[model samples]
Target: MKRLAGVGVGWRRQLAHTLDTMEGLGFVEVLAEHLDARGPLPEPLVRLRERGVPVVLHAVSLGLGSAEPPSPERLTWLARLAERLDAVCVSEHLAFVRAGGVESGHLLPLQRGEDALEVLAENVRAAEAALPVPLALENVASLFEWPQPSFSEARLLSGVLERTGAWVLLDVANLYANGLNLGTDTRAVLEAVPRERLAYVHVAGGVKHGGLYHDTHAHPVSTGALMLLEELVARLGPVPALLERDDAFPPPDVLVAELDAMRVALARGVARREAA
Candidate 1:
């Protein structure tokens, strides 16, 4: 697969105009659940396609890491949307949002036990079988970690990629948040993940609430997260990264400037890599 260079943003209705006018955006990812696979694509998104920007379909409801099999209907919708948009790929969390028929209402981290790994591997294969394009698994940030897990987060993610032959959508902010909360080395997390399998990277903002840095994506990108992103680019050589701002929409100019900052960091990393 071609490495995605430059910065992208998660396509939001509120930022449509900003995204449309922005220069040098490498790609955008649209939330799959917001779209109807049977209907015509959103006009703005269609325009992006017309402008030659790659779109990736991102899903939150698949609950792929659940003990149960992935929802067939959700997978079908993702497949249809991907085919319709000619997306670069389809991605979902390596998390389970529901269990025993109960919805968690938020993405929940999975236990890194052997059983969980096997279950996740099976679900990933099931998803890949149904997806028209490649399925990439994203690592999520959590306030808590499973006790006495059989593998580290890096090992579990790499195992899933190995078992299913899928892609890794490494979220740098999530890695930083996890490090802050769990007290692990965030840089080690970045280094340990299988860089060759990385599909892209995600950068988002968060706030320190009650002593924990939340990966809320509702604030500006923190300095530490940007630094981690630079480290990732230094290791992987300028993989595609999208700034994810889900709420607290900033002014268009501010968002553009944030992207510009990321672009500069990415360029520095690539230049250093090339020089080395």
Candidate 2:
């Protein structure tokens, strides 16, 4: 698979015009659920595909970490969407949102253990088998973790990657939240991820609410997250870095400024690596 490179943005209808006019964008991700498997893709998305921009299919409801396997229909739709858009890859989170026929309405942390790992590994394998392109699993920001898991966060992810041969969508903001909430070193988490298995990286914004950091994605990227990203770049050189903003859309200039900031941070890290 070709390595995802440079900086990117999540393609949203709110920012479609902004992204459409922007120059030098690396790629853009669209929600798989929002797209139809049939033809007649979204106009802006079609324009982006026409411009030779790589589009990644990101799924929220796959719930790969759940006990149940992802819906066959959903997987088939994702596969069709990837083929329809010529997507570079399809990605989902490591957390589960549903169980026992009930939806959590949010991505919940997985109970780390043999059973959970096996279930997740099975789901990932299923998705990988269905996707025409590669499948990438992302680490979510956890509000709480299960006690004394069989594997560390990195170990669990690495094991899944080893078992399924899937790549990682390492989210720096999520790592920062997890580190802050769990009191673990974020850099250690970064180090544990296999650099070669990284499909891309995610940087987003969040806020501290009720004494806990939330990966809300509605705010600007935090300093701590950007620092972690810089450290990651120092270790892995420059990989594809995608900025995600889910809601509370900002002005086009502010969004562009954030991308510019990431570009500057990545450039500095690349320069430092070359100097070393």
Candidate 3:
């Protein structure tokens, strides 16, 4: 894949029009929950292929960061999508969303420890084996952090990556949201993530309730998230960066403009780096 510029719209409803706008605006379009194997990708994805737009797969329920192994059913679906789309990368949350001996509805937070590491490793390994593209693990904007005997967040995450040999889809906005909500120092969290290991950035907006933040990804990037994103792009260099807006969706013009702003900011940064 060629170098991806600043922003991408999270593929949501009205996808045809969204792709049309994104194409006109030079924005990459990230594929949505089409990770399911029911049949082929959602019809909107075909429009992207016709337009020759760059596409990446961002999964919501891989449950990689959970305590369960990647289920055979999920693996079958992912393999189908991966082979069909020729995706740049496939990604899921670092937190487990499914629990139960069957199907858990909640996106569960894992206790940061050795046992958790084994769970993450096995899941990632199974996913990597099936999908030809790079397998990516995303940082969850967790509402709670479990008390662990030892292994800090960085240590646990780094250990999983080291053993599994996969990449990280760093969600900078989630990092900030966690800090804003849970009082977890976002910078310390970012440092724990190996700078060189990041494959892309998911930039999005969120809301605050009392002391907690929800990863709504349904608005323009927050002022604080924007600042942190700038630092990330500058330090990490030009990687595929995507904007996720999943609710209270806006008209295409407004969404495209917001993404364009992010694109310009990132381009200026890349230009400045070259001059320096």
Candidate 4:
């Protein structure tokens, strides 16, 4: 198997310094905004591919698990875009961003209970049917709680993936951030989801404000987040691990150094797991 390491960043648009640095770092996936079925990729995305990096479509507006069906127009857009890139896969969150026919411009949480399964299943099927590669779903960062916490995040994710036979993109920092904010046990969160569905892992840094831990995707990989990732690696074993630094991108070389550190940590984890 390949080493399965990547320096991943969100968005294809660029600033002179940002694009130069990203190109230098040799990121594997440029999480593109427009994987719609019919439009041409922005010039920068074409450039990223020219450098031999693969692009994956991570849509902000694709809200598959929403109350209503995801827009056919958007799905068509994604299908066209996927064809354009020969992408590995397309990813969206386990989120309901639109409700009652209104776009919230954010990934809003559903009250994670029994009522959500049918809706999620329907959306997953729709999303999978339209894409060539398996549709991977990500766990979202939540700052609020429901009056009734129906199922753990893992169970919900596991259920949907199992039903749709889709892939999962596990975000460790999202789990850590939710754990800190909601006082949820991280191990229990880990235990509830199906480890087998984990196709890749994401690690990012966040902000601590007003006694709240927010998944802001700023800063460097924190000690606690890195520790949690180490734990995840031990349990789940090797997966395509990547860092998501959407904002305040350090110079390209600096981010690559951080990616190198992450690899060292992952190697240590794999060794410990194998030894035990």
Q: Please estimate how well model 3 matches the true structure, expressed as its whole-model Cα lDDT.
A: 0.70
lDDT of 3 by residue, 1-276 (tens): 334444566676554566654554334445545445556566766677667666667777678866657777777776677667766767777877766665566566677778777878988898888877777788877777787436565666678878886888778788788777667666665666665667677888888777677778776677777666666656656766777776777777787777776777677656665766
Off by over 4 Å in 1: 1-3, 274-276
Q: Which residue pairs overlap in candidate 1's backbone? A: none
Write down the TM-score of every candidate.
Answer: 0.96, 0.96, 0.87, 0.87
lDDT tens per residue, model 2, 142-254: 88988888767877777787788899999999999999998756766788778888999999999999999999999999998888888888887988999999999999899
Give the Å shift of residue 85 in candidate 4. Answer: 0.8
Off by over 4 Å in 3: 1-6, 24-32, 35-40, 193-196, 267-276
- In each prediction, how many residue pairs overlap at the backbone (N, C-alpha, C within less than 3 A)? 0, 0, 2, 5
Displacement of the residue 148 alpha carbon in candidate 4, Å: 1.1
Pairs of residues at least 3 apart in sequence or in different chains that clash in candidate 3 = 65-94, 97-107
Whole-model lDDT per candidate: 0.87, 0.89, 0.70, 0.71
Cα RMSD of all models vs. native, in order, equals: 1.3, 1.2, 2.7, 2.9
Q: What is the TM-score (0 to 1) of candidate 1?
A: 0.96
Candidate 3: C-alpha RMSD to true structure equals: 2.7
